[model samples]
Target chain A: MEKKDGCVKPSKGVIQTEETKSAAEPVQNGKETQKMLAKVGKPAPDFELSAFFEGGFKNVRLSDHKGKWIVVCFYPGDFTFV
Target chain B: MGVEVVAISTDSRFSHKIWQEEELSKMVDGGVPFPLLSDAGGRVGTVYGVYDEDAGVDIRGRFIIDPDFNIRAMEVLTPEVGRNVSELIRQVKAFQHVVETGEVTPSGWQPGKPTLTPGPDLAGKVWKEWKPEMAFD
Candidate 1:
């Protein structure tokens, strides 16, 4: 079932357990996997981080975008995938 | 596309700089129009709850913030999957339309399409008027 915010719970078959960890392996679906969290309509947690922008090294703070829409996307690592 | 897209990764600034200069620059030269932010310390990822503490990195997490800075949408994918950039853009456009017109878009709703007016019976109203092609059910 999907939550009010459009997130669907993984089917029972998709949930992995510790017992399955060692003896079993995730079936490859020939698709890329992603990890995500945060419910829509909820307050986004604030944070301060360093960024390499065109200008120079700078502190990027979530609160800094107070009046603007921010698309914060997290990738597993940099330069690994394009 | 006036929306700002920021990509965060746990890689260090030096590595980020090298990648941007060596690789990302090619995309910028080829018309990639957004900025990539380096989350060297993983602080941003941690706060966003996408952090993989054991791996010392973040999982795929996408958040759409409104003009007022409230989170309007959030999607977390498993680490092996990547996000759909086009869908993100579409969602931004749909959100912009809703913010401007005060109308709500149904599932898979796109621009220039009919949007439902909000009321006490919003879900049912939306469902009743929803096109079968647009809905999962």
Candidate 2:
């Protein structure tokens, strides 16, 4: 969503977990999948990820970004590798 | 033509805040253009196929989704390589142009350049109508 200053801000959340080992899998139609998707022609799996925005936390859903192009980037560590 | 950029990492929101404050202070406005997502559980990272389980970190995975939520473009890369923002911007512009005008942008297409109208007649004659000299930088 665009902020009052006209700059589009990102939404994020924070929830630490003990588990770290998992495989990447493809998501089913509209369902969350842990695997990598096969191709880029299908609809993206719907998901809600918590985001950090404006010094606060909120839930950001993929479906909420409909009607506008969305760029989802997954990067490595924030402090170490980023 | 509105586009939103979201990034996910295996760091907590607290870490994101630190990066924004300490390291990313030189950003355009003192922070990233978009929000840095906190994929604390590694759920989003794993789903997008960028996480390295052995390192407890993610590789570089980028996806461009159209307005209808279609996966228009995606690139999964190793952490050693970084993404190119200029190329990504070009692609977003190209995709939006097609969605709006129903015309396909040829290779090396930038804004305000020539576009090709896909049709049966143009099937094997794209080079005839579009010459490389006609391209706009």
Candidate 3:
């Protein structure tokens, strides 16, 4: 099994109670909505979705690739620029 | 020399078929060494952070990932403009070179060319050996 760091791994069955909801507060929130979303020097989020390939559509999951480079490029709507 | 290029666009398979049959097939006839992927549901775009939520479409985004699945570089171009394939190829080659040898590629660098040694004190060494025609100082 793949092992993750302790900070990212949450213990099982650790559910937040109602009291914890009110205690939690926003640490620091920014209001820059719709900003430049794509960023470099970060982990590219993996995904699996229906894609048309090899003359047919297939479900492609990101985890399907255990160790391989995946260049996921997203273009605008087909047949229309902008 | 072995790299996978996956191109995704928010379009139905039918539309993708039309594009391949009408336009891309011609490019393939000429020379297109890659396959085009159709993101019919736009989910892949959403995960890649390229989805235009209001417009319900994805912008132009390119991601370079290493064999270990770590993203090394990414570029998202404006919708009005297109990306430079030559520069993309150059970057892929440069990254491959760096992975093979501990070297840094200057801007506009090409393969089989000299590279900079990454160090604070070696700036002058890089600058002295740098070629202005490369468009990097």
Q: Specify the highest-lDDT model's number.
A: 2
Candidate 3 similarity to native, TM-score = 0.71
- Ranking of candidates on lDDT, top first: 2, 1, 3
List the RMSD of every prediction in angstroms: 13.3, 7.8, 9.5
Best candidate, TM-score-wise?
A: 2
DockQ of 3: 0.30
Per-prediction interface RMSD in Å: 5.9, 2.4, 4.8
DockQ of each: 0.28, 0.47, 0.30
Better of 2 and 3 by lDDT: 2
- Global CA lDDT computed for model 2: 0.73
Candidate 2, residue B128: the lDDT equals 88
Identify the superior model by lDDT, candidate 1 or candidate 2.
2
TM-score of 2: 0.78
Off by over 4 Å in 3: A1-39, A63-66, B30-35, B38-41, B119-124
For each prediction in turn, the share of the native Cα contacts (below 8 Å between chains A and B) that it retains comes to 0.68, 0.82, 0.63
Q: In model 2, what lDDT does residue B15 have?
A: 78
For model 3, name the residue pairs that clash: none
CAPRI-style quality class for the chain A–B interface of candidate 1 = acceptable
At residue B8, what lDDT does model 3 achieve? 74
Model 1 lDDT tens row, B12-91: 65666677778877877732344556665455565466788888887898899987767898888868777788889888
